[model samples]
Target: MLDGQSFLISRAVPGSCEQESKWIYMTQHLLESSSNKRPPSQESEEQEQGDRGKRKKSPECPDTPDITDTEHALDLSDRQGSDGDYDDANSFINPLGRDITISCLLRCSRSDYGVIASLNQSFRSLIRSGVLYKLRRQMGITEHWVYFSCNVLEWEAYDPYRGRWIAIPKMPPNECFMCSDKESLAVGTELLVFGKEVTSHIVLRYSMLTNSWSPGIVMNSPRCLFGSASLGEKAIIAGGTDAQGTILSSAELYNSETQTWETLPAMNRARKLCSGVFMDGKFYVIGGMASNTEVLTCGEEYDLNRRSWTVIPNMSAGLNGASGAPPLVAVVNNELYAADYAEKEVRKYDKENNAWITLGKLPERSVSMNGWGLAFRACGERLIVIGGPRGSMGGTIELNSWIPNEGPPEWNIIASKQSGSFVYNCAVMGC
Candidate 1:
């Protein structure tokens, strides 16, 4: 046998084996149900037992924090002496480097995220940075997900590719969660659930990457039943009711980069409980109940380049007397779609002839709980509709996905769940 001095370098740099062993343990844990953590696999148990009798102490990483924080990457790199140790604390290594690794993770489906997110802190930090999402655009990984909160406050997301449902982290607990039919907006890497605190008006944002909720920058005015839309990194909210429950015409823009809100010129017509949609690089505020008895059909357009708002003509004759919350509208490939609560059908906006085309009716037993029951969300270039047709107060609801590009649309029932089935709000991320 070689002497200690001669075999020093061959002993394997300190705790390399331990690091490899831990990675295997965590990966096994990842494959288990997210609702419960599982023990290491039998292979890992056997490996641990075999090594137990021959175990020998190795040099420990000095000043080595748990590596749970973002700064740990730098710490590990520096400790490894120029060339970092081969033991990457992260899950997988991309031969191309960290950028490629991030892009790969971003390209993964949302259902995969839950498993990956449970793997390690480094993975979480990279995802939360929103850098991967930007890379996704460059790589054209635009698989979208439809997320909605139903009878329960917690949100659930549907993955079109997988044709399944996965639970998202719960919103931060609040005594009184103020949610409107269209209050949820997905901007940048985060989803903002706008509402008023029990005692005051406040907004809460849930970050998908971090898997935690954080207080969002408050709006200039506290409003309920507002029109909201997201344009990737930025979001806008306009024309709702202010504190004390007064109707509002004010509008504001949110910049995720600055984490602040900026006031925009108010709309020409005051609208309460209106719906907003982003189409053709413009924001449109559609029909809303102007008063207890009157519903406003007039709509307005915000031209970001012009920094101006122009009043558009009233909607097609069908929505002339639209009541309650604004119609449930979603934009897919620059075309606008509105869900008709009365007819339970989706209508496509025809710009050329200025008419609404009846696409198809939603699945039977959908609940138009709040006029916005047909929570419509744009998934990539397709559409995901949530809610069943006029079901019993407490019953099951279906999540349907439709691809407009595929000629006439057909509903693919992706999931069914038990609830009072009243969906207060829904949003789509990873677009």
Candidate 2:
């Protein structure tokens, strides 16, 4: 509901030729791209036309313009300088010298304000040594709630603004209420949690206003370690291990309005611990382990409107373990990113060009156990990594905010409690 304005700030050295040229090139790119798009709104279009008419006519060029030739030559020199300066400047900045800090405003009910404040203070001390790049307020689902399968299947709402996590009423336990490696996705006011116990199944509906969980529908097949994402009004679940411990290629969809689960076409290959993201109205499934025998290079996509699956380019590196859970696939500046659990590297996928590039490596080693409960969210404009194994729970980092002059940022520990929270398989709701 917050329609805040987004701003960009640049602080390069004054009059630096490399910085100036790069800025100009980026501006030109934006101008050309905008020109090809649809015209601005009617009022803005009229304003633009009026401004054009008000411009004074330029003087006619002489037989040979004095500045034209020099300008043309300088353009070529600037282009050459751009390439060299980019490389030189990048080399000068250490890849590991950057630091980022992430802050979140915890809002809870008036009764639980003190608890929320404690969390905020604890988080501040946890990452006080690092730079903060992200700050987000957690979205509350009714009065302070937390949903867990093993427990009473309760719901709690946390108010980051008030600093509280309040527990809501309990839900009726269904026939099979157990879910391991549970993954949840949020669409509007509904939360969809999918997991596998003895069967691969999904718990469809949880409303923040209702403050309770009700059975909406179940998946066509039960799956574990699957990837889930929300696109518009629908939630998509794809690629996971079935009851038999075999990786699965199938996918399912749940329409929030219809309150039903429908089968979509399966993926190209069986994958568990794969990363999935919904971007530009499509679902992208990336790397994971297949059959416990091989790490998969398979990637696929499902069209929301068409209800079809298509094989897409695979990831640069295969991922497995805790790295393939709910928030693994993150969209930063229109590009898809996933941390390769097996490779300990982060990769970015360019949807426009169908290419994969290594963004960088994780600050620490990879963790392979209980690969679930990892959560990633955009705090402000920076991507915040939270709650994964191998020093991840308290660990946080910024995405793509680094520049050549600024160097690669460091991961700051945000929450160091020994709660041993599963980073990959947990549900995250943020404002």
The lDDT of each candidate is 0.62, 0.44
lDDT (C-alpha) at residue 338 in model 1:
77
Give lDDT tens digits, candidate 2, residues 196-289.
4454455646654334567656677867678776543466788887677777889988766466778888887877877677666678887777
Residue 186 of model 2 has an lDDT of: 64
On the 0 to 100 scale, the lDDT of residue 169 in model 1 is: 64
- Write model 1 residue lDDT over 377-422, tens digit each, in one string: 7776566777874445666768877767535568887677776466
User: Compared to the true structure, candidate 1 yields what TM-score?
Assistant: 0.74
Off by over 4 Å in 2: 1-181, 196-204, 241-247, 321-327, 342-345, 351-356, 360-373, 377-380, 388-407, 410-418
Error of 2 at 50 (Å): 53
